[model samples]
Target: MARDYASRCSLSPVRKTWLAAAAAILLAFQGIGAQKVRVEEELEAYPTESVDLRCQFIDGLGKTKLTQVSWIWEPIDGQRDNIAVYHPIYGQSFPNLSFRDRVVFLQNSLENPSIRISKLRMADAGRYTCEYATYPSGNEQGTTTLTMLAKPKNSAKVVTVQAGSKSVVVAQCEAADGKPAATIKWLGSVGGNHSTTTANGPDGTVTVRSEYRLVPTPADNGRDVVCMVEQRTQEQPWVNTVKLSVEYPPSVVIEGYDNNWYVGRSDAALLCLASANPEPTTVTWTAASGSLPDTVMVDGNKLTVRKVDDAVNTTFICEAKNKHGASKHQITTIVIEALEDPSSAGVVAGAIIGSLLALLLVVALIAVLLTRCRRQQRRGYPSSGDSIATGSGGSNGGDYGNKARLLFSGTSNNGSKNGTGANNNGPIYTYREGCDATGTLTEKANDFHHHHLHHASVGNPPSAHDILLSGDIDEPERRKFDLDDSMEEEEERYDRFGGIPGGGNMLPPAYHVRRGHGGDEEVDVYLDDDMESQRDGSVISRTAIYV
Candidate 1:
């Protein structure tokens, strides 16, 4: 459980859910009272829609007598006294010849007569005064002026873009046959540098565009943008305006030179890029448990660590901040060992080694005791079983030698070789020099016994015993023999010694005996060479290899 806890220590689900919901609510509230309208803050940018203007209060009984209301205009240059007149009372429209068919108003409802002046010319682009005479309680007159200035047919276009990338921005202001083509204005949140111009066409047509771009950030995500279309003859700053909404999302990234490589002292860098539509205000770095270096430096999209040292092993943190909120990154660890000190670990290492050595000694002593006890159990009849114990007699035939004779079960108390042979009628002589080992070998013979003697042709065969590997079985270079091969080989090899046949099953690393194929003759001569000897002629055996 402790391991699992260390594996994950981060934000939980409930906190994350609450934070997200809160952020969404705050953004919605920011937009509630932000919608507004104006005439010409920036004329080059505007939304395309139907034109609607209602002058309802101009006549106090606004909707009544809607049919009686009409319009009139005077021609420019005094070419005629009255350019045109629409009189619902006369049920007639009389137009001066010079201004004939030049104007029409399609709307009624006691609103302002929204007139469309056709074949508009430079002289037509002037103050258009709407004169109203109302019969509401008293006679009253009022006027509102709309200066008809030549304006562009199309507003400057706006383009959407992603944050944290380089880009180019360009827009054109164009119109056909306006008195003087509109001027283009480019506006944004920050430094908006733009070039303006007019490309003249036949008959005073004009094309004007603004050219500019900037690398955007999250802070630039949704900024109110505007472009102005200024007409030369207009008294106001602009004849029309266009509003642009630039939308880009928050972008966070790691950028650097060889960021994943092991960074070095002076030639390395770490770049943390934090950008958002609403615009982040600040960026910072922190250490998990230590102070951040004083030499650290930051730029718009980059955070750099200078002259890193061994102390750089501390965890590093990145933070991005703005007025709305802030975000932090998970701690990332870096280890810096300036130079390895081989001798520094000697003291603690010595203590660990000493403890392990003491443990090994205790384990070895317990293992020895267990081994001796098990061996005694397996050899219940050892005193009568071990025989032909051939060795160079250090003190010939003494009490110890007599004990050896009794252990073989060969000689009787009267110093006669007891016979379990065909010549059991009398005492038997032991084999020439082998008698000292078994107190003597039996002279009672059979062809099978002669075959068994062939195995002992040399001096004395090695004692039937098992040997362990030089060290632990876990050593890679000293791979062990498979249990099955070791056991099978042990049984076959043990038959060469004097161990009797028909013992119960034995595990590997143990000595045992078995009868020959016929199962009638007991093969007492087993040939196990494995011993504690570890001698020059030790034979190696394993399943993974073949000889």
Candidate 2:
């Protein structure tokens, strides 16, 4: 009862008044109130799917005498038709029309009358009114609006066209034959304009088509364009992408010419490059003035100059041909006078580097020699109160030969000196005097002992002949002889008191002295006959020496 009252409240005043009168008459005859009737207020379904238009009557007042129930269709265009009906005695009836076999009552009785429609079409979308009539009460009806949905077939494609100034169709998108039209939109990274047109089908379906227009160019080739479609049947918008193909004639470019070609230059070449959708078929090289010179050699797109000369100083032309069209490029050649050889720079650089390295080597050698000389000078001479022994020996024999030795006594006392500036405090130096003497260390020591003892016998100091040559040899005389290179290479032997033992001597500074048998003074003398002076003012003998 409450459901029937609510449905009546939603209707117009005329409908409410008619329902109130029917309820009053039913109450007056049977002493029972009106019963609730229900029908789906709204219904939705897709194409070819079954849908149920529900209509039920509740006899809360105990069978208010239901006579007949019928299903009616009321389209939005005001066209009406009776599609289904149910009666107690006449049995189920589906009208003999478009919905004859496709629609029927779910139950063959009037208690809960509902209809099911099969093989539904887009035109089946309309208002369905389920009407009921009885002997006591009048008609009671409920209306439901049925909505149909469809998913459109979406597609997009790009059209190939030659490059032109005027605008033309470059891409297209379509959403075909969808219930309740689908919307289409164009999008891309490129710039263009699009137009949309819609058409309605006889079966109540709509088709939408969109075209994109743009000025075509070669640069637009392979660019992407997007098509987006929206419809009621899809949860999200459908999208498709297409690449544009724009064709054009061949474009040519020339490369590899520096314009510094000289008369004697070689290995000069130029290349011709062409860009097009279809690759170039033929490449030709020529001279702008006339035929190509004999100095030039052409290989496909490349032109090489064997030897740059006056003949190769003409403008060069390169032509490329393809199916679309032909294109050409040219470059002028300027030949200058032959300049200095390029390799000369490397030769001069190498020479300068070599000279600097040679100078550096010489300077390093001079530095090493000077350092050695200073160290030798400092070590060769001993100071006062110091003793030193220097000698040179060879492997020629066990006998000593032409030995030059220096011996220092640690005596600081001043003593009488000969013209050779001999002093008791000065070290004794042995001078070579060309004398050839050969003996072993012991024999030489014994002989020096005998000679020094003979000098000590007369109480006479060592004479100048013992330590100096006959006359002072000048610098020129010192360098006049060939000095022995192995003077310092020989072995030198020392005595028990190898150095001075803090003792004073009556003789002048001695040369190459050693301890004799019986603790006597001994000296290893150098003979002047076998001696030669070096450029450094030092004397060396070619003969081997001992001790």
Q: Tens digits of per-residue lDDT for model 2 on 1-547?
A: 9999998768788989999999988778663234356877898898899998888876765747889999989766678898888889998887758999899888887878988999999888899988889757788777899988778989999988788898999999999988779999988878999999999887678999999989988899889999999999889999999899887888989899897898888978999988876678899898988999998999998999999999988899988887779899999998888877776989988999999999999999999999988755533323333322222232223212233333222211121121111122333333332435433221011123334435633334343233223234345534432133433232122233243458633221233322222222322232224433333333333332222
TM-score: model 2 vs. ground truth: 0.59
Give the per-residue Cα lDDT of candidate 2 at 462. Answer: 40
How close is every model to the real structure, measured as TM-score? 0.23, 0.59
TM-score top scorer: 2
**lDDT score, residue 16, model 2?**
91
Instruction: Compose the digit string of candidate 1's lDDT tens values, residues 1-547.
Output: 9888876876789999999999999888764322111111111211121222222223222442433333334334343243433345554353556445655555543344444455554343222333344443332222223333345554555555545466546233443444456666665565556666667654344666565566655455455456666666445554333333344443456555443323355644666666654577777766776676665676655656676655555556667776546666634546354353445579879989999999999999999999987754432222322333222121123212221121111211122221111111121112223334433433321222333234332222222221122232234322322334544564576455444256633323322233333323323322234211112221111110110
Candidate 2: stretches off by over 4 Å: 1-36, 257-270, 278-284, 289-314, 321-325, 332-547
The lDDT values for all models are 0.42, 0.68
Q: Judged by lDDT, which candidate is best?
A: 2
**Candidate 1: which stretches are off by over 4 Å?**
1-82, 86-91, 94-99, 105-126, 130-140, 147-194, 198-207, 210-426, 429-547
